[model samples]
Target chain A: MSSRLLSRAPQDTPGTWKSYLGLGVILLVSAFPVYWMFVIATSSDEAVMSSPPALIPGDQLMVNLREVFTMQDVFFTASLINSLIVSLAVTASTLFFCSLAGFAFAKLRFKGHNVLMFIVILTLTVPNQLGVVALFIVMGELGWNGTLLAVIAPGLVTAFGVFYMRQFIGHAIPDELVEAARIDGALTMRIYWTVVVPAIRPALAVLGLLTFVATWNDFQWPLITLNGTDYPTSMVALSDLASGNYVVYRRVLAGAFVATVPLVVLLLVGGRQLVRGIMEGALK
Target chain B: MALTDVRHARTEEPRHAPPKRQRFWLHRFDTKTFPYLMIAPFFLLFAVFGLFPLIFNAVVSLRHWHLIDKEKNGWVGLDNFTKLASDTDFWDALVNTFGIFVLSTVPQLLLALMIANLLNRKLRGATFWRIGILLPYVTPVAASSLVFAVFFSRDNGLANWFLSLVGFGQEQPLDWRAGTWSSWIAIAVMVNWKWIGYNALLYLSAMQAIPKDVYEAAAVDGAGPWRQLWQITVPMIQPVVLFTVILSTIGGLQLFTEPMLFDENPAQANGGYDHQWRTIAQLIYRVGWSDLNLGYAAAMSWALFLIILVVAGINALVTRRLGGGK
Candidate 1:
């Protein structure tokens, strides 16, 4: 490892300008649409509708935002809060449930453990959206239609989260540690709470961040469950604004831009962890 | 403060379970009941939400379920499937779904591969580059698609504006959402934009995990960058490639939000007015929600599920053959 580090150090030589230019162009294209979104959000209707549309940002961001908030009976603030609530609740429940289940699978083995674990892994292969037909009908039957719970309940703990946590717990914590905890008269649940949770916190963090981002961006199920209702969610509500018969393009863009700021901040904070979690979930 | 108090209390022996009968319950919990309880939520939830829906959907597909008399269930075995066979909308949606999938996934993966290679180097600002590539992945599909819808608007959208700047589509600003192929292209662009960075970073991380010694040894053997990339990088990343292929395959038929939101009608989930780009998912939503034909929608759902399974199964077979080793 030390020699590997030394050799990797020599690779720290200044990168050629070609590499920079290549990456620069890629990043620009990758990020330009988002920038264009900002440009539209802050521009006037005449400006947005101008021939050879404006590339530069304009100063009507607050004005358009005001228009967006004022147009709909659905307040933009309620949508934001609803989105945060759903994402955070799903994240919290998924982390706790998946980690607990993963620890049980990894450390505290019981009867039918392998079979249950196999089922968990197998379910990962099945497409999740296939259940939507029944889920929506059942949601209506249960009077959960247009409610966030209809969306949240099914997604509270995912198979992928369980698989991810199991992998992390299996590798991170040694059997001796679990055995030591048990011998210390720590009950099984107690050992998991004290030992497994802290030991697998990094994986927990990764799973939590990924789940939050995924739930935040999940459009279809929420779109279905919350469809044709005035119930609040950022994405569904945004689509409502977008598809309105006589939507103000610039104003709707402003609402979209406003809704994206939190996610942009999340990307800044959780970006690297998100990448690692995905790779580790796949390869590790 | 309250959490710490609870933790402190948990460390002490439980005075609540003082009776011998209660002690047995605690022992059972610590031994046999604990693990099952730990994982029960998943199984319980899956049985209710996952397995039950799948099974119920199969049954729902067989019945004549309509909204007019929602509670009335008339047995119509294989009738729904027969309708699906002749359903032009189903076929059109099927073609569009695969078309969008191929257009989006192929280019997305190829570009992602190239971008991953560029990002694989031990370069400065690696974090920044990773974040840049990842920015789109984090953006909500609704917001991004809404932005793209605006960008691809009939006349005044920015896409046409830029294209016209290059003297293309100058005489007439292309109405993106009206045409069949053009609408497919527009939706494909949005899908690719959202996923390319995500796939690239994943591929990048997987590439970084490739042993450094392999590249060094190949370099010493006079293998140039391109040669080494083909000879080593591609072969080594085969599993990850396979993984991405499977993921993309599964994600393909589930394509809903981007096209659903990118449509000209804005809120139209059933593709567009003529159903030009109506994907299988949108078709299912249309049948169940708009037409209020639960049986037909359920039938379509199962059919879509079958398509996914068959396509994924075939791909997995080819991938396994090419992958030689796990």
Candidate 2:
């Protein structure tokens, strides 16, 4: 990791014009669909469907936005609230439980640690969706069907989350620091809450961002569990809107833009952190 | 040294006369119990929600279980598997999955490598460009599918609209999501659009981790950028490329939301009117949920799981070869 700092762009030569042109094209293709979505969202219903498609934003933004906000069948407003609540709940539980378990696995000496850690890592290869059939039945038995808890509980602590947290805590806190706490007569939980948690805030922040975004953007399970609900999630609601009308491109685009707004805002706020987190995650 | 040895030996010896200590069960301070308790939630949940269901699915797949009617359930043994072997829809879905996986993943990886190579250059606003490219990834699948569906539509769609504007292919309109190839191509576009930049960023990061000194030394030896890329960069990032390929394999096989939502008829998770794009994941859903054939659906899931495992094994073998056969 220090190689970056050590070298500091060792080949920081001037870029040629070809590089800029190529980058410009890449950027255009990357961002154009999003820009086009914005345009269609604000375009008149007729202009949106017209041949050659509206190249620029039209003046229907206020109307379509209002329609999306008020659309009952699509349940945009209610779904947004549901998404926020469920995502926050899942994120909170994941952060707390994954970190606690990570601290124990990384720092504490205990029986079955190696075996348990192996199991955890092995579980990473088994996609959770593989167990969805059983999970569905379990939820039904627990009477968690059609509830947010179905979504929240299953995702509360993921194997990858544990692995990630363990990696982070392993690198961040040294054994000597932990031993010092032990000699100071601090209980395990006390030491964890005070010294360990504060020391690993950056890693935690990355995990928290990833967890929240993933939970927010999750679909299939939510679609299965929260199906037929007036309020499932904004993503599901967008799908609902898309499928609801025959050719309501304006309203659909409007809802899509709304669904994407939070994520875009999140990017603008913590894009660098997200990129770093993803990089760190990829390395692991 | 003598004094320290004596002290260590004295401490090593068990003390017979002990102070008052807490009880094992009631006090609960011994044997690192806290650590066990802390890690228990994940295991417990995985057991109940993950492992149990997986095992149950295995058992249930062999039985003639129906969702609505309990009396119809009976031991069917390997009937489900045998039936799936002869099932044309299953094969078609599998073919479609593989077709799309290859179609999208190949170009995506190549383009990603090219983009990574470019991004490795000294460019201004590199961060902005990188983040901007990843925007499609952050967009919810359902939302992006809607936009892509609109773009790929036959009538009033962007492709045909542009074709007409350019005075080309006006006679035969671009029906982007009708035929087998067309539907796969359209879905591939969406998949590639969502993933290419993310993959590029990954490659870029891997490239960044590669020391520039190697490139400079290669340059001193008169290697050009193109030569350096194929010889140095590609080989260095082969592991990442392999990782993404395997990951994309797993993901592409499970392709659901885009194909599910892209069709005009949302009910047709079967891909299209002709079932040209129904993925294995969607097949599982159609069999289990729509057909109410729980046993068959479970069987399909197991089948899909086995295929993924086989592919993963192949991936491991390939990885070994990549590591110089060590």
Candidate 3:
């Protein structure tokens, strides 16, 4: 394993300037739209219509943000707060429930474990959106049609999260550690709380970050459930701003730019882990 | 603090052990029933919110249901499905969905493969490069789609300006959302912009897992860089390539958000004035919510689910053949 790790040293993969140049161009294309967003967010309304359009940041960011916040049609600030509450609630519950279930699947052998696990893996391929029509109806029947509960409840524990946690726990927390805990008379819940949680902290972090970003960026369900209401999430609110007969590009981009800052910061801080988690989730 | 408290309490567990009968019961509960309890939430939620809805969609599609008039909902027995069969709008949306899927996914994967190869080498500021490419992926779809909508706007948009700079489309700037092919290309650009880097990173990780010795041996056998890439890198990453193809197939077929926001009137959920780029998802949304016909929407939803499954299966089959034949 150590030799394998050593083989990944930079000396082995000698890169050329052509590759660097290609990457540079790709990065520029990746970043320009975001930069353009910033430029329009900070510029005047005229900048959106100017010849060649604004490519540099202007001083009207405060002005555009103020316009967006105080606009009577959309609840921009409330949407941000709503997104935070939903994302955090979903992340917390997903972690606790999935980890507990993952531990049960991994270490604590029980009846029907393989069958139940197969079901979980199978559900991963079936998009939940396939049933959105009935789901919306179900929400209405349960009197949760317009509430945040409709969004938060179904997402509290995802099949993907359960499968991911199970994979991580099975690999990271060895059977011997679990055996040792059981031998010490640790109860199942006790063992999960003590031995399992700490061992899967990295997995928890990865899952947490991915879930938060995904929830924050989620659009379709939230749009259907919360559009035109005062309780819209940030993404729905941004869509609201984008639509309409006459969209103020400055205000629209300003709201979008503000909503995206937190996710960008998350990407900057936990990017390596986030990338690893995504790749691992796909490959495994 | 909680962990340490648990540990401290654990060390003194034998001093005040429970009675044998109580311990036996506790042990039984812990070993036999606890795992079921741990896993019960997932099954319960899935039954209520996942499986039930999926199965119920068939029932809903078979009936005549409206969004607001609950009293008038009645059994119609596949009428909605038959209506959908002759619906040109639905067919157009299906065609648009597949059109945008092909246009976006083909280029996105190809560029992602090239970018991954570039990134799989030693480079300065590697973290910057990785994170930089992922900028669009992290941006909210609503936000990025709106930004792209403006960038592709007809008169004063950057896309037109660039076209002029390249000595084309100077007289009449292209109205991106007005034409069928133009709107698909515009939405495809939005889809490709967000996903290319993400797919690149996935490919890069897979590339890193290929042992260095394989490349060294290939190099020693007089395989140039291009030959090594085709014979060694491409063949080795075939599974990952197939995996991404299926992934994109599912995602591309269910195209939403980008085109939904790209619409001139998003509240109406119309893809364009001519229904140019209406996707199956948007069509479902329009029929269900805007038109308030839940039964037809449910039918469309099931059809979409089947379509995705079929397309994904075909992609998997074709990819396996291509990989193995080579």
The lowest-lDDT stretch of 10 consecutive residues in candidate 2 chain B is B18-27
For each candidate, what's the DockQ?
0.51, 0.44, 0.55
How far out, in Å, is residue A151 in model 2? 1.1
Q: What range of 10 consecutive residues in model 1 chain A has the weakest lDDT sum?
A: A4-13
Q: Which sections of candidate 2 miss by over 4 Å?
A: A1-14, B1-31, B165-167, B315-326
RMSD of 1: 4.7
Q: Of the candidates shown, which would achieve the greatest TM-score relative to the real structure?
A: 3
lDDT of 3 by residue, B50-155 (tens): 9999999999999999978778799989899999999999999999999999999999999998888888878888888888888888899889999998898998
Candidate 3 lDDT: 0.88
lDDT by residue (A1-284, candidate 2, tens digit) is 33333233323644679887888898898887888889999999789877778889999999999988887777788888899999899888888999999998999989889999999998877766766676777888898878888888888898988999999999999999988877655678888998899998888888888888888888887877776776578877777777643658888889888888888888888777777787677677
lDDT of 2 at A221: 79
Candidate 2's error at B182, in angstroms?
A: 1.3
lDDT of 2 by residue, B1-326 (tens): 57556443234423543334533342256336888999999999888878888899998889998879889799999999999999999999999988988888789888988887888877888788788777877877888888888888898889678778899669888788788998898899889998988888888888878876776556645555676677777777777777787788788778888888887866546588888898888888777767878888889889988988887678757755764434
Residues B71-156, model 1: lDDT tens digits: 76799999999999998989999999999988888899899988887877768898888888888888888888888988888888
Model 2: residue B29 alpha-carbon error in angstroms: 2.3
Tell me the TM-score of model 1.
Answer: 0.92
Models sorted by lDDT, best on top: 3, 1, 2
Give lDDT: candidate 3, residue B294.
Answer: 91
